[model samples]
Target: MRPPVEVSVLILSLSAPGVFITMNNIPALQEPLPILGMGMVVLGLVLLLLLLTVRNLKKVDPLFYVFAGFSFTCMVFLTNALEQDGFISGFMAFYLKMGEPHLRTAYAVMTSYWEGVVHLLLFLTIIHRMFRGKSYRSLGLLWAGSSSAIIVHIPGVVIGKYGSNIQPAFWRNVPFFLVPFWAASLLFSRPREMPVVTADKIIAEQKKGLLSRPVDLLLSLLLLGAMAFSVFRGFVVLDCPLDACFTYVYQYEPYLKDPVGFPRVMMLVYLFYALPLLTVFIYGLKTPGCSWMLDWTIFLAGAMAQTQWCHIGASLHSRTPFTYRVPADKWWPVITLNVLLAAVPALLALRCHNNPTYFLKPVPEGQTINEKKKN
Candidate 1:
């Protein structure tokens, strides 16, 4: 008899391919897209022009601009929810089919229901802002949530184009990918780095150096560790060989190596965690008098915490196959690390909030504010 593992793999082999890759089930085919996609863009732009020309568009928040730009995003969400097929669901399905099957399934589920919910609420919020001419208090949460969703989706589309039957040609599927990012950029645009109070000034104010504070040192190091691990794990997701020390931690989960979970999650980790940590180190903590960087950091902590919970919860759930089950023995490390990922940011945010002078130190001498804004 074949080994039990081989039998299990063989059994899964029959059901695995094309979990969400059915051409016949295409949503656009079911309900034509020309009027929906490009037409909506034209209409949205027209309405946007009207809103800008007639109304004080400046009164609205930046995220409102994203919603206005992605005017038909509600329809995309609705189409996916109703028909279980649409541009987003279809394109992501095709893309994920090339790599891990679970990612397609996850993307489909997220786009279908989760997206339906988010897009609807996001639409309402935008309408509220436009009509009411006021922004919601939950601006930070809105930015973090919307940005994280698009952040995860990007790596899937990018990596899926490799080695799959999915045509690598642009233009064919470019709109679906570009639109999300364009919206995301609007939602999370950063301000120009403000000039920092000089170190002499900080000393004059009797504020301690960022690293001198015990709490700041600990939180900074904690985020540093998370960033390093995320990059190292990216190598694992990319199948870069690692020596024993690294694998013992990151390689614990078999399903993580599967395209669906680890790869998608890592994309967020790299974009959100790794890069932000470096930014915080350079300007947030090291420099003085930056904008309320701590406020954004706090919101990110909550957002990432929620994201990890979703990733971990979904992975262990029955939807994923036994072939990629997370080993129970390895559970603590995963959960603990993610919890830390979530908590450390909050702690840093708290630390900064409590002592603004420490976290918002002045930018380095000769650093131009407009140049920083361009970033």
Candidate 2:
């Protein structure tokens, strides 16, 4: 018999493979129209609940609320995309025949409008977070960087819509817009010099033997590494024209052709995109101090919703065979491995809650006390 843990992992793996699977031999599920409708209803109910609950709840950092709002807006855009692609004949027909000039033009217009809104909101949230506790000098630098990078899209958008102009405006402006945002990220990433809990609180909590320093350090390191990797990759992908070309050639094309390759790329992309939620999960599971579990779960749900987008793009275009449609002998193992990779972090998140030793040792007592006092 499989170990209970292994069995649980396997169950999770199969149950939600589509949520993380990018490229697979399985037939891509059509956008469930009923499910989408139901989801919108549920979202509406949740929003109403949030409005009511927050009024009675403590005033936590407004940044958290801002992030939540951005996340919801992203979901709204995603739902709109789904409705357009799934229910609207004109939109679906246009996307299906992407090579058509008129369709391409329409797609360019609609996609640009939606993407611009999403990016603008996301950028605003990030900027708001950066400026929350920092000086205007720091905020100004970030503003200059993010704004400059975003400005490059203006020419790129124009070029996509109109014929190339004199002096090659968009192409020339791209780098100036990208470089500073990356530079600002590196400049801003300072480790918290203060303790998360107060010195008195730590002493009080220590009496209960609840504080585990090693676990805290390990979780912190994991979160920091994940965040740093994501930001670094974002910079590399955004700033390097060569990286974009390679992505278009290798990752993008394979995604549209090979079913298996689609999931692989998607898994990689989600691993990056989900880093923030993963960090929250790690911290919450390790500490169990705050009520971020709900937030983490919601983020995970949002990530799962996004997997549909990845599969929709590939399935609509690709001619690859579905793995599940193939013989059990051929594709099950590949599916199994992909599922395992996706399940590992979730299991780790759960285990960390009960086993603090899963992470590193606590900071030295004197250091912990000093840090807490400084904070």
Candidate 3:
């Protein structure tokens, strides 16, 4: 099936020059913006001021300065989103044209809003807590998970669809892609601020069966449903031959079939990564002393929230070709299902956080006696 070497070489030679020319001819391209330099200066000055003036901030993790600086970019994200929607203009004109042509994609627009609103608030909250000498490991992990998901999917889509159009400035995402991993490792290594729960409380909470806890039972069922939905959508995006998949893709979620590749990659992510987590969450709810659920639930909630926000918004946005956008008649049902999918993980995180005794390690009888003797 291989083509002749001469023919293959000829084809590539012919196409490469055109790709370069197209990339260089981006509409509205202008002289490079100073935004990047300005941001670095601003963040550097803020960090220096904090290190000198704020005694509490000096004791905080160094990454706190980085995040505190990154939070300022959230406003830039909001401006980009507004410009993309035509409510404003010129804010991101040069960047969009030369820096990241892929930002024109519907998915990127939604992601911008998410970073601007949700991520901004998260960073500010963590910064405030850090300044007050409070533990913010949970919030930092949430941000880490959310930012990681966004960084992964956005670049995947860019290379998937706009590989030929990539410009030099696109490489600026290198830091964005790398920093989350560092931040995540640092946050995970931090000591958790464990809640005060007596031995009796841990024993009582862990002793209860799943059926005895109505909320947990409901969450288990909802997570099972989410797992199934994730699989079904994975099939839809993969172009399964089943009647349901065919009908669902065309009539309900045409965006899954878009050639842009974001939706397809996103579904695959859900199927491969999220499905296993959902099953484990169900197990965690039913079993006692599943301490991992507390942290993982928050992490999963952040991932699901970020992914669903971008996916749903992209599916409904006007930029999606009319043929690929969700059908008007199916809009409400589709939105409801996707919204609930995103909400289930959030609820699980809340349940684990609010009453974590069930997820805590069971107290050993000998250890409890030793503690009593010490008292």
lDDT of each: 0.49, 0.37, 0.76
RMSD of 1: 13.0
Of 1 and 2, the candidate ranking higher by TM-score: 1
Residue pairs whose backbone atoms clash in candidate 1: 196-362, 196-363, 287-361, 287-362, 288-360, 288-361, 288-362, 289-360
The alpha-carbon lDDT assigned to residue 245 of candidate 3 equals: 97
Superposed Cα deviation of residue 172, candidate 1 (Å): 9.3
Point out where model 2 deviates above 4 Å. Answer: 1-69, 84-329, 358-375
Candidate 3 per-residue lDDT over residues 1-375, each given as its tens digit: 654322322233233223323434554334344434433454566456445444542255687655755565566667678888998754566667656777788888898899878987787677667756778899988998788776546546574677777766666566778888798888877767677677887788888999999999999999999999999999887779999999899889999977777888888889998999999999999988888898889888999999999999999998888998999999999999999999999999999999888988766544542354345
RMSD list, candidates in order: 13.0, 16.4, 12.4
Any idea what lDDT model 2 has? 0.37
Best by lDDT: 3
lDDT of 1: 0.49
Per-model TM-score versus the true fold: 0.58, 0.31, 0.84
Score residue 205 of candidate 1 by CA lDDT. 37
Per-residue lDDT of model 1, residues 274-357, tens digit only: 566545654556555655564566456545654555456545655555655567887788667766766676676666556555
Candidate 1: which stretches are off by over 4 Å? 1-65, 68-104, 107-151, 161-206, 243-251, 260-276, 279-283, 292-310, 346-375
Model 3 lDDT, residue 24, Cα: 40
